[model samples]
Target: MIDQVRALFAKNTFLPCDVSTIADDADLYDAGLSSFGSVQLMLAIEETFDIELPETLLTRRTFASLENIAEALSGLVSKAA
Candidate 1:
């Protein structure tokens, strides 16, 4: 799951650094993730995880970092299961 998130970032131009180099708690926004990039990332996440993100989870906080995204995906997948 984490790898998929990293892959999305790597394939996109939202991040300034390599996905592998980003710290788990690094601020993705500070890493140069623009609003457009966030949306793209969000879409990629939804597609890759096969989960529909709730409106409440669409905030920047949900995509703030690798750890956050993993937690969000874990929660969503568990709920579906």
Candidate 2:
């Protein structure tokens, strides 16, 4: 999942930092994730995971970092299952 997210970021050329440097718990916003980038990331995540993100999950806390995103996705997947 992390690899998929990283690939999306790379495909979009969003972040300037090394994708490998991004820890799962690190804050993507603080690490230079722009609003536009977040939108793109959201779209990529939705497409990659084949899940419609809930409105409630569309918050800074949820997408703050890779870990948060993974956690959010896991929750959604679990619920759907």
Candidate 2 lDDT, 11-81, residue by residue in tens: 77667787788887888888898888888788887887788998999898887888777778877877767
C-alpha positional error of residue 31 in candidate 2 after TM-score superposition, expressed in Å: 1.1
Candidate number with greatest lDDT: 1
Summarize candidate 1's per-residue lDDT along 1-81 as a digit string, tens digits. Answer: 677677777777777678888888999899888898889888887887788899999999988998899888888988887
Q: What is the lDDT of residue 61 in candidate 1?
A: 97
- The runs of at least 3 residues in candidate 2 whose Cα sits more than 4 Å from the true structure, single-residue gaps closed, are none
Task: Evaluate candidate 2 by giving its C-alpha RMSD to the native, one decimal.
Answer: 1.8
Candidate 2 overall Cα lDDT vs. reference?
A: 0.79
Model 2: colliding residue pairs: 24-67
**Residue 6 lDDT in model 2?**
68
User: Each candidate's TM vs. the true structure?
Assistant: 0.86, 0.82
